[model samples]
Target: MMTTVVWLRRDLRLIDNPALYHAARRGPVIPLYILDEQEDMGGASCWWLHHSLRALQGQFQSFDCPLILRRGDALSILQELIRDSGADALYWNRLYEPRTIQRDREVKTTLQAEGLEVKTFNSSLLNEPWEVQTGQGGPYKVFTPYWRQAGGQITAKQTLPVRDLGSQDRETASDDLRDWALLPAKPDWSGGLAWRWTPGEKGALDRFDRFLEQRLQLYADKRDFPAVGAISGLSPHLHFGEISVRDIWNRLGHFEDVAGVETSVAKFRSELGWREFSSHLLYHFPEIPEKPFRSQFSVFPWQEDEALLTRWQQGRTGYPFVDAGMRELWQTGFMHNRVRMVVASFLTKNLLIPWQKGAEWFRDTLVDADLASNSASWQWVAGCGADAAPYFRIFNPVTQGQKFDPQGKYIRKWVPELRDLDGDEIHTPWKVAKERTGNYPDPVVDLSVSRERALAAYKSIK
Candidate 1:
């Protein structure tokens, strides 16, 4: 009689999933996913979700619990399911996105009013956004203190090995995956995406293992280099909650054989801390997605050029490094973290476009696009966010490309038009012979002139 409904969201993995674990304790469980328009999973993300859900469905099937997929209002569907199944309890892991928070709170209130046993737990963040705060009882805006506080307070709990939940029968109809239209149609642009990523719990674990075995040792030193291939590339995994940060944290400490285990662990944890910081920032300042955190930036002159934005999106900005990053993003639904900053800087600074515009584009393209992370990062690059890099430190694209993708291998891979150009010539193809440059476009704007323009704009605002 104690059937429980487990509402699944970003936390797709079954292991160490507090919601799934607790729900499994209460007799038979009805696992569910309800997709709605509120969370606009863009083209690339949708493709990943389709595959990830398929993988997740298989996992649930092995446990004899079908992950019922429904496309509509979550509240209405859950209520109907509850009525039909007579489920007495409901549980879910927390989501911190502002709109999602409001939606969940309303859902919880409505469900609790209906006399259901409702409970929510932290399965997403190592430290829940509210849990980590300042001495004055406020959220920490700066990262270092927040990181120190969070790291000191956080500990990984043991994962739930298995749950002995039995099968549940429900007459409620579920939507077919294909009907959801969570994939591209007409042309299927996800071909490159398919070749690059594997998006599920198993995939997350495998990627994490690879990162640990190969890249973790040099992650601190080489992570900023686009060509280094030292990063974990686990953003999409973390975004979808295929693996928990705590799981990642625990595994990060398993580098005893490496010489600089402590150093590497610290560096990697700092990166995770930055993720936590983004979540924390979003929780406190919900306006990050739309408004600049720094108030003065509200009046900053921004170019509203769709044509320029199109060029930027299509990797024809003619700045080889920026182009490579944009192309990589377009092709694989990911860009190296360093190149992300460089391209973002190029957009919000050099081009003087609104950060929100770039943020929107990323939201539509990135498989790993979490609202908080995307907004926070774009604003940081634009110097309009909390604890952002100073505006004066504009990234020189050619120098950045030369420094990071020094041998231009990363550039060559993504921007093949300049692939034949030797060394640094790959970073500035416009400077190369027209025949050698092939069809690569000229730089959209003079780098030095644009830098000065951006600086002047910043100075005027300041």
Candidate 2:
């Protein structure tokens, strides 16, 4: 009997998985997952990884396939598996992160050299990052034109169905999931993550179905509201390839009103486009994870305030909205998209801190923390990325809170100190009488003065 190895990476799901489908077609497939610590697994990322792998294991068992786990460099582990299993072919879906891309390239070269048939499929995004480019043959720096071109190329009719695999499970050596310890041990801080997501293909499909049934119509208007379940909270699922972008695009075809459907679909699709844009930027400019994409940002002075950063991370920044968003992230491993932008701006602009600091924090904390999204978004807020928000457009935390969380319900939920304050008082608790019994902290910085300072620093770079 022919033998094949299906090496799982970011795409952990069984349904609609291209690699697993193709592997089963060729021969009896051995499912494999590698836990490589040398590769950077940020704090919150580790938490998600642990749960995601566990979920994948459950799915594999249902299919009667044993998921073999190994810890080391992927190339070494794969070679060892190949030698032991005597697999004729190896297959996996593509990954877009810089380090992942590099690692895959090296692995493919080495494997092919050893005469093993190696194959990869684009299962992460609707379109490959390199496939879309500007008319000038360069990658797009701005979102609008890139999104337009991407939308024009993608059609609902083109989506591939989830290939079915016959009962062709192969025997393999597997490891205990707990031995990997992808989660924290001593502190066991992942209790928050358990409340946030189901972390598998089943969860992704459920979210998609619910969004189409209930929330897709009002996505454009209600997405900005943190308190409402207006937006599709599928970033982590998308990041892990639990669901495909094509799956989402095809499902949105039911809405008939052209204007409303187009508006909502266009907005939702653009977010997926943003994911592509981030990968494209990272691909063309791999240095962005460490340095600014724009050269001038190197000269832009950034403050070094570990104390303030700690306050921000701990959700003690004294700004209700900022503290609320940070606390939301801490407790749930997720934050609203608008608040993500606001908190990013507060870190880079208000605190005069470097975007790298904020990016690293998000990387360490966010369940959906993606290299492309986290790095690009932070740089965008810092005005140092491609087509970034103007640096002078520093977010006024007070105005932002009053605008988005107008009722202050979101603030009160996360910032318990201000829980007793009424809607009008919760947003600006400093203005409330001290005797009112709300134990809210004062403003961390003078907003008006800090805004001016941020503008001046931005002007110096310009």
Candidate 3:
């Protein structure tokens, strides 16, 4: 009997999965998931990984397909699987991170060298990061122009349907899921995470459906408010590829009852463009993880304050909004996108810490912490990334809090100390007599003074 091996990676779901669809078309596919111990999947990420894999396993069992798990380097594991299973072909979806790209290239080359048929398909984003470019034929350095070009080329025709796989011979020798230990061993810190998400393809689709029916209509206006459930909390799901961008796109296309359907769809599509831009940036400038994107930023003086970084990470920073964001990130594996920008700004601009330090923290804390988005967004706030915000544009946390979380509900939920405070007073609790406490601490740095210092530092670089 003809046989093919479908290697599951980031694209975990069976529905609308191009790699799985193609593999099923070729022959009876042996579904495989290899846990590569050599790769350092971050701490917070491991929590999400465990849950996502559990969901996938349940889905596979329903279909009578065995998910064979193995531990080793991917190349060696795949080679052995192919040799032993007598699989004629191997298939997987693409990943855009720099290291993943390098690994995939080597794996494909090695597999091809061994006379094995290896195929990859695009199931992650609507467009591959390399497909979009600027007028000069290079990757676009900025987001707006890149997004416009991408939108112009984007069409509904590109989304493919999920292909059904016929029954295949069941294989034994599958490793027990418990042996992987993908979850935390002792003193499980996942209590907070449990309150936040349900990881799976079905959960992802349910979220999308709910958002489309209720929240997406107000997405443009309400997405920034942390207290409101206006934004689609799909980043973790998207990162894990439980749902495809094409699937999301098709769902949006079906909305006919909304008044400004086109505008809403356009805005949401632009957000996906941002995802593409981040990946494109990482592809071109792989060193961005360690070095600044702008050459001048290499000389930009950053303060060495591990204590301050600790305060930021532990959510002890005196700024209520900044602290709220950090705490929210700690409690849940996700943070509101607007709050993310604010906290990042506070770190690089107000605290004078290096963007890399903050990026590393987010990489460790965020369940959806993607290499491209996390690094690019941090660098953007730090004024050292491609198409980054201007160096002089630092966010004033108190004002930002008042503007975004006007009712103080978001701040209250995450920061219990400020829960009883009302309105704008919640943002600057020190001004209130009863609220002020020696225990609570004062603002770490005066906003005006720090902004001036940051501007001067950038000016010196220029």
Provide TM-scores for the models.
0.98, 0.96, 0.96
lDDT of 2 at 455: 88
Global lDDT of each candidate: 0.89, 0.84, 0.84
Please give, for residues 30-83, the per-residue lDDT of candidate 3 as tens digits. Answer: 888888786667778888888888888888777777778888789988988888
Give one digit per residue, the lDDT tens place, for model 1 in 1-462: 699989999989987898888888878888889897677777888998999999999998898777889888889988988888899999999989888999999899999999999999998788989889799999998888999899999875776665876787655567888888888989878888999899999999999999888888888888899788899989999999899887888777676446776677788888888999999999999999999999999999898999889999999998899999999999899999999999999998899989999999999999999998999999888998988999877898999988888899998998898888899678778877899987899999898999999999999988
| Candidates sorted by lDDT, best first | 1, 3, 2
Q: Give the per-residue lDDT digits (tens) of candidate 2, residues 343-440.
A: 98998888998989998888888888889888888889899999899888888888899999999989988987787788888877778888763556
**RMSD for each of the candidates:** 1.2, 1.8, 1.7
After superposing candidate 1, which stretches have Cα over 4 Å from the reference? 169-172, 256-258
Off by over 4 Å in 3: 158-172, 434-438
Using TM-score, give the best candidate's number. 1
TM-score-superior candidate, 1 or 2? 1
Worst lDDT 10-window in candidate 1? 253-262
Predicted structure with the largest lDDT when compared to the true one = 1
